[model samples]
Structure formats: C-alpha cells, structure tokens
Target: MDFRIKWLVSVLLIFGGILFCTAQERSKPLVKHVVLIGSDGFGAYAFKKAKAPNLRKMMENGAYTLEARSVLPSSSAVNWASMIMGSGPELHGYTEWGSKTPELPSKVIGDGNIYPTIFSLIHQQLPNTKKGASYSWGGIGYLFEKNMVDIDFNGKTDEETMQKAIEFILTEKPSLTFIHFDQPDGAGHNIGHDTPEYYKEVEKIDALVGKILSALEENNLMENTVILFSSDHGGVGKGHGGKTLLEVEIPWIIYGKNINSKGKLESSVVTYDTAVTIAHLLGLKIPDFWRGKPILEAIKYEEK
Candidate 1:
C-alpha cells in the first residue's frame, strides 16, 4: 500500500472513532429522571453530628454545599415553597402558616396562576414527562401543581411517604419524583432542634435515603436519575420562623448521572436552585420567573 494512502486511512479511522464517541455521549441523555428529597428542619450542624453513613456516602459521590441558604422566615412552608417553585415568598407568596390560598382548590397553592411551580413548568413544556410527589406534611403539596404530578400522596408518616415514593419510582419511572420527610421538624418542635433526638431522626432519614437509592439501583434506573437531597429550613431551638444562622443554614447534596464526585460547590446555593438544576439536567427550560440558576460547575462538563 502507498504510504500516503495508509496515513490517510489511519487519520480517517481516528476521526471516525472520535465522531462515534461524541455521538454516543450526545445520545445518552444527561438526566432522564430526577428525585428531589426534602427533609424538614434538617440543619448542617445536625447532619455533621448524626451517624449517617448513607448520606456520607452520597456526599462522597456527589457535589455538596453546606451553605445552601433557606428563605426567611426559615419556616418549612415558606422555604419548601421557595425550593419547589424556584422563587422566594415574594413571588410564590406563601409566607405564613396554614393554607396560603384557601379559596383556591387543591393541587393549586400559589398566590395566583402567574407563578407556576417546577412541576407545572415541566408538564406544560413536556406533557409526556411523568411527575409525582409524596409529602409527610400535606401543606407542602400546595407548592406544586396537582395535575402535573401523576401520583400525589400525602402520607401520615415519613416512612410511609418514602415507601410510597420508592414504589412509584420503581413501578412508574416518573420523570420527576419528590419525597418530603417531616420527622426532624416534628422532633425539632417537640424535643429540640439540635438535640440528640433530632440527630436520631436525621439518622433515620439517612437510612430511608439509602433505601430509596437502593430501590432505584434495583430497578436499574440510577444511571439516568439525578438524586438531589436538601432540607427546607433549619431550626434554632424548639422552632424556626427566625433569621438565625442555624435556622437558615442547610446542607445540599447532589449525586448521580454525571454529577461531580466529592465536589464542593463554593457559592450561595439557595433552596430554589433545586428546581433550576433539575430543569437544566432534564433539558427543560428554566422559566424567566425563576430566581435560581443552574449549578453549572457541579455537573459533568468540561468548562470552556
């Protein structure tokens, strides 16, 4: 064979291999499913003190930030609302306790129809995507659009809520699934926020997290699912509704599907960022009304 022809063939083969690899990477969707787990009244200090092997392992395999800020008054309703809607109380307008808009029907909890939640946005943009949520505190249901979630369950306890969510994920393979646990918040109000009892509840939640992950793994869906774990707000003593550091500081953990392992995000990651990041991963558009930005660096992509 001619030397020039041989060299040309070698170069063509290398270029073809590169093209194939690039095509494969693009063919694999960055995120096909998202699991957002919200633990009420879970603070960074309590997370540090608790013996949560599962959580630690998740953190080791994902990008985390202990400084994820929660919107004030630091109450679960307000912050959870903010987290899901990707907006603050000023926009979503669910600041106080109880039902925000009692006049509005169930599955619709925002101030008006203007500020739709992440679920609503996802469903509206991609109607084919399946979404669901299970909450221990029923009030949290108000943050999301009802029709958007295929399976919505407000359970009696955290265990029941998590079990139902895991079952839903395994069986239905929802594009988005949210699970809210309210035990730490209950322990915070009943006993103390930073007490040993609160830590025990945190440990239990960690175990629950492990179970949820295991279910995803068992179903072979972990590769395409992005798992994000965070808390609504932290409590100071027996309650929140304050502006203290302990009450506002929260731990945010992101794992699975190209997320950086053992990565630490050095930025002001608020609770609302959850919606933004999820939207970005699933190739959905982040609405202009959203106040959060995607944590672009934490994801697996070579910075240009």
Candidate 2:
C-alpha cells in the first residue's frame, strides 16, 4: 500500500474505535441506585423564600424545576399514590385516606390492564434488587406492599426519618430507597404556606436533606445514584386539597448519576411521572398501563 494511504487508513481505524467505545459508554445504564426524597407540602414559593443552603447547592448541581405540577385534588394521599403507582386516583383506587390498615385489592402485581405501584413492579421484575423506604407519614405506608419493601420504616419526625434513611443507605445499600419528611407539611397546616414558621420548617428539611446527602457522599454512593427530590403536594392557606397554584405546583430536583447540572429544567413534569422516571433510571420495564412518561431530557450523555 502507498505510505499516505496507509496513514489515512490507520487514522480512520483509530477514530472508528473511539466512536465504538463512546457508543458503548452511552448505552450502559448510568444509574445503579435511586434515592427519592419526598418533602410533604414543600411548595416552590416556600422553597424560594426559605433559607435552604443545602437544597440550593443541590439545585446548582442538578436539573431542577419549580414548576412541576401535582395531580388533581392535591391531597397527600392522592398525590403520593399517583407518584408511586404512576397512575391517577381513578386507576390506583386510592382516592382518599381510607383506613388505618388499607386492604390489598384482588391482585398484587397487576397486569397491563391494572395499575401497579413502582415498589410492587420492582419486586416482581427485579426480585434480587433490594428496595426500602423511611417515611414520616405512616399513611403513605398503605400504598406499599409489605413483602416488596426490604425496609419499611415509619418515623414520626423528619429527624428520625433522615436518620433511618441514612442508616439504610449505608448499611443495606438498597437498589432503591425513599426518604420522606413531614415537618414542612405539618408546618404548612399549623401556620400557612410561605409563612415564616413554614419557611423555618423548610429550612429544617433542607438540613435533614444535607444529612442524607452527606451520608451518600461519605459512602461514595453519590456518583452511581440518581437522587430525586420532590413533594407529594403543596398547600395553600393552612390546607391543601384544592386546585390553586400553591396546591398544584411543586418543586422537583433531579441530581447525581447522569443528570445534568445545568440551570432549571423547563420540562413539564407531574406527580405521576415519578414512578416511570424511576423505572427508566433503573433500567426497568415501564408498564404499558402507566400514563406517566420519563423525563428523558434530564439524562445527560455524549453521543459519538
């Protein structure tokens, strides 16, 4: 072969190899673990007014949107159910806070016809992968399956919830973990949304969030984890359950793993999108019955 022709072929082969490697890297799933943080009644307005240094820092490193909308009715039970089940109240059949012990329906793992919670779907699809949650609102416990969750702790206060969540992350290292804080909601009901006392609670929740993030950092799990910070519903005038702006709009922050650290995300997201997004991040099969769609724009990757 001619000398010049041989050099051009060698350069082409090298570039092709590089492109192949880049494609392989992009195809691999970026998230190994998912951490979902739920702060009840934490509205965007309150988040703006609150002195949440920790959460602000996280927003700087993640894709965030204060315009994320909640489901109709805007109640805690309805919204949590929508987020977990990836379906509206009509499909999930959890319209209201029913009983202290909510009974299981006909089927646990619903087919394409029936709606299933993300926990149940994960348990059925990825049996070996561990799943857990530490929630302050025990009522949310009704939405989960006992056998599906490895650790289903109901802490009475935000402090206890964060403590248990941090411990679970470090000790169990579950594939999926959910942490819920209830103080802000309680504060919203006690005082009012955007009130000084409510903002104080929001700040306190920020500190608790910092503790959990610190735990992840200490364990070196931040890079491989997708952390989703959100709220079930926002409140208005000392209560929620209305379609007003304060009740419908909430803040959502997606950080870590392959998430973009750019400015606020303009994507329109709702409570129902949480489960499908989690499934997508963990590389699980999204059920056809699910109405929510994954926020694919949040994923940042290079293509060759």
Candidate 2's displacement at residue 17, Å, is 33
TM-score, per-candidate, Cα-based: 0.85, 0.85
Would you give me the overall lDDT of model 2? Answer: 0.80
List, residue by residue over 68-111, the lDDT tens digit for candidate 1. Answer: 88987788777887787887877777776554552323233433
CA lDDT for candidate 1: 0.82
- lDDT of candidate 2 over 268-290, digit per residue (tens): 99988988888878767766667
Q: What number of clashing residue pairs does each candidate have, in the order they appear?
A: 0, 0
Cα lDDT, model 1, residue 271: 87
Q: What residue runs in model 1 are displaced by over 4 Å at the alpha carbon?
A: 1-29, 102-114, 302-304
Clash pairs of candidate 1?
none
Clashes of 2: 0
Each candidate: what lDDT? Answer: 0.82, 0.80
For candidate 1, the 10 contiguous residues with the lowest summed lDDT are: 102-111
The parts of candidate 2 lying over 4 Å away from their true place are 1-28, 97-115, 302-304
